[model samples]
Target: MTEPTDKVDEQPLDEYLKGGSSVSRQYRQLPGADVPPSLDRLVLRQAEEAVKRPSRPAWMRWTAPLAVAASAVLVVSIVLETGLRDETTVSAMQEKREAAEAPIETRMIEEPASEPSANAPAADSAAAELVMPVPPPPKIEVPPPASASEMPMTAVQRRAPPPPVAAPAPAPLEEQVAKAEERDNAAFVADVARQKSALEAAARERELSASQRAMRGEQAGVAGPRDTVETPEPKAVLSYSRPISASAVVTSADSMAKLEKTYTDPEAWLKDIRQLRKDNKPEEADRQWKLFVAAFPNYEVAENDTAREANK
Candidate 1:
């Protein structure tokens, strides 16, 4: 029984030494994992009867683990050395500061800001070294790390303002003056044209009056030569009227009372004058027109009609 158990244990080694039994078959069946070419060649050489190669040394089996441990030890040593160096530097600086301040107790300097006496002793000069207090460590207030929802928002994009527009320059002084003078000249010409039109209208009115008077058996000629001619008094005329939106025209009692000797309506008096003219009665038409003027002193027709009749 002992012999069989010994054989069972050694069987796997023997099988490996020989072609490596069932495990090799199962390894070959892994879907995409290919056996390395070098490993396959080594296995082929081992399987052949004539091929002879030295087995790997025992120490070679521990090579990978030893390399890994060496790397880990190196990294750990570097980290520890860095920490020790930092601590040593801080302690050295503290000791140096204490050594510098310890000498201040031996001296009796009252004013720290004032200069020392010019004849001070060498020992006092050496003892009166300037001492500055160590600055406090900066308070690095590290805020808690924000969660996904509390993260700061992106910077807002600002729109640039519109660019300033250039304004047009004003006209030159000389050009402005020329334009004003041209405008004045044009206005003067328009005034002259208006006066000429008024004179032509007056001439036409005089001709019509002469013809009408001639038909009514009245003389149609100028009164006398220029030196002896007397210009008649100018008749008054008014044309102001109420706007269309106003209520009916309202006459005062005094105005109605003043119109005693003439027809109430200027229209009726004008019609009566026209009828007398048709009957070839110039004197009667003239008389009625005079009464019409007295009745409605503000009639615009009074000036034109009176001018026509007076010239005739």
Candidate 2:
């Protein structure tokens, strides 16, 4: 059996070499001098056929895999680099945001007042750099914003004081009435005084005339002058007596008593004789003179004896 099996295998090999087998065992083997020309020719034909046909190039065979590997490495490197950069960026942004939200410290500044020069400019940048930092606009006490209802009303201020109010003028009619009243009062007082003086003068004139007429009549009876030849003396008229009513006159009790004591009717007649003599009216003064003659008869006797001698 072993010998038959070996012989069977050798038969297959022989058939493969003869190209008469249904199956063949193909393998690369070294070329030999004993190799058939037909087989060599077949092998050469196969090699020529393979050479004539197109093939995948060496660079093409691995290009897809190498491209995939390179893309993965780039993705991983970019992810790592992005992760590293994000930490610092996020930290810087956060610090900037905090700083922006922080409140600023308040400060106050006062600018000095100065006399402006005509030639100097109002503001200078060089001067501003040298100037102490203006801390801030004087931190105006910024009171919290007021509600609409609490807003203060603004009133316009007057540049000058309001004009003075004028006093009211007097009415024309009232002014005229005051002036007229002043004039009327003065005229009334003057008229009163003039009337008093005139009345006093008339009383004195009447008293003198009455004494002269009385003396003239007595002298005319003694001389027997013709009435037509001699001018007649004017008659006298006595004026007012003392007022009877107390209401009509102002008088003192002493003055009233003195008036009553001073003159009886006969004494008044003697006063008339002396008053007539003082008036230089001897002719019509006899009636007043007769009272003195009756009072002193011896003086009348001397007067009659002198008259008798004159008649003789």
Candidate 3:
């Protein structure tokens, strides 16, 4: 009831807005200018405009897209590389597995067993490339079948027959006897001939030496009687005991006749004389030729002086 008589009641905020307080009235009386509805909103809008200014950098906007693209490229590269490696590994593994499961066979090669030739090269490259060959078993030899007599001997063999002791062989009786006789006769004849020839040569040399001495004395005017001249003794001559008898018969009985007969053919004697000349036995050839001429004066071509000169 007291409030109704007073004329004014307690005011609410909306009523206070219609009638201003001291502070609000002062603000209202300042000027009739338009005020913003929200000061905070206006400040926010100014800050957004400052951020969009021309002088500000735009790098932040492009950074996110660049990073995303780089990440995507890196992921794609890693995936492709992984796929290739997996495919290669799978192919290699499959090939190895197939080879391991396959069957295997072994084969042998044969080669001749012989000594290498010395003329071949010291280092043979072909031999190095060759595979080693397996060695064959040793060969076994079978003995031949024994005869009936040899079978009994083989059964009776004790300690292998003492390895068959060999005996010295005897020389032939007839050949030995003939060789002994020939050697004895040859030695005897050679001794006799050598002695006779030595004696004859010594006598001839002495005689010639005495003659030369006498000639030297005579040249010096010293004279000597013929009976006082010194002479060498006559030498004994060697002759065969008996002539070899021939199957052909002749009328002449003396040794000279046999000599004439032997010299008549003249081929052997001529050949012997020629051989003596070839052997440089001129003294023996002279003696033999004189005898031949004396015995075979009627021989063919032997009587010719030209043939005799050629022989000399």
lDDT of each: 0.37, 0.34, 0.37
lDDT of 3 by residue, 71-104 (tens): 9999998887677656645543342222211100
Error of 1 at 112 (Å): 17
Top TM-score hit: 1
Show pairs that collide, candidate 1. none
Count of clashing pairs, candidate 3: 0
lDDT by residue for model 2 (155-228), tens: 11111122243114335333443543333222222322232233334434444544554556544223321231
Residue 171 alpha-carbon offset, candidate 3, angstroms: 84
Winner of 1 and 2 under lDDT: 1
lDDT of 1 at 9: 88
lDDT computed for candidate 3:
0.37
Number of the candidate with higher TM-score, 1 or 3:
1
List per-candidate RMSD values in Å: 43.7, 56.0, 46.8
Work out candidate 2's RMSD over C-alphas.
Answer: 56.0
Off by over 4 Å in 1: 1-51, 106-312
